[model samples]
Target: MGRTALIVIDMLNTYEHEDAQVLVRSVREALPGVKTLLERARAADAPVIYVNDNFGRWRSHHGEILEAALAGPRADLVEPIAPDEESLFVVKARHSAFYETPLAYLLGRLGAERVVLCGQVTEQCVLYSALDAHIRHLDVVVALDAVAHIDADLADAALLMMERNMAAELRPNGDITFGDARSD
Candidate 1:
């Protein structure tokens, strides 16, 4: 039996990128699910790790990155799922959270053998992160309704790949449960 961690990826964003409008639209639909997962994870006392993109702000830390997102026009989206004091933060410069990041070591330290992934860019970040986690032999779960995507078709294909190719479980946020490792 092993612990489970909720990995909220790249939800803190300024929505100032090339396809941000499309991404924001999907995110709006997915927001409630993401919020629900956050609450459930918190209530269960499971580790909630926020693995966010640094947005090329080399000097920025978690606080600074969060501040920038909250100050952006799309702050509403970030507000509901903002990382609390109990949430762990990891800044990543690449698509995969584990790439050049301490996420693997952190997960090991926390004894998290399973991870539930939620957040933006289903076709990109989420896809890559799932593959990385799969190779590392971590059980991966992707919350379908809790993830936003830029392209619908690509996102669909990505989810299939995560499920069939990577063996990542695909479930809606409502079905996800968190807590003790043995019970999970």
Candidate 2:
């Protein structure tokens, strides 16, 4: 086995969208698990990557994106898992983190053969990203409790699809492992 990375997807949100109410509820529940994974990954010296949507901000970078999310109405939600200086960030324009982004290349460079996924929109971004990662031959593990969703039904179905079709390992955040000294 090579290295493993923790990929946090679309957690930096303004929550100013159509499904904000529903999504916010799920986010609140997932927050603690996401925080735990972030701490564990950092402590073990494992790669922590924040692959976030750019919100169509063509010129904005990660810092600007983070600032905007923090300044939003739901700053409380964004603050807890905000990226640290050591966290690698990839600004994505689409649902899948691997879509038109440098994420695949970055993973390659980091020697990360396996990726542990967490963060929001389980039925959307998280599901799509997992498929992309699977097709790219990278092992994928989704932290179930650490992912928020807009629709519970769809989220459940997505999880089943990821495990049944994509062969993704679906596990709770606490059960996730970074391997070697990083194992927890």
Q: Global lDDT of each model?
A: 0.95, 0.93
- Estimate candidate 2's alpha-carbon lDDT, on a 0 to 1 scale: 0.93
Error of 1 at 47 (Å): 0.4
Top candidate by TM-score? 1
Cα lDDT tens digits for candidate 1, 55-140: 99999999999999999989999999999999999999999989999999999999999999999899999999999999999999
Highest lDDT against the true fold, candidate? 1
Candidate 1's displacement at residue 4, Å, is: 0.5
Q: Please write out the lDDT profile of model 2 over residues 31-127, one tens digit for every residue.
A: 9999999999999789999999888889999999999999999999999999999999999988999999999999999889899999989999999
What value does the lDDT take at residue 43 in candidate 2? 91
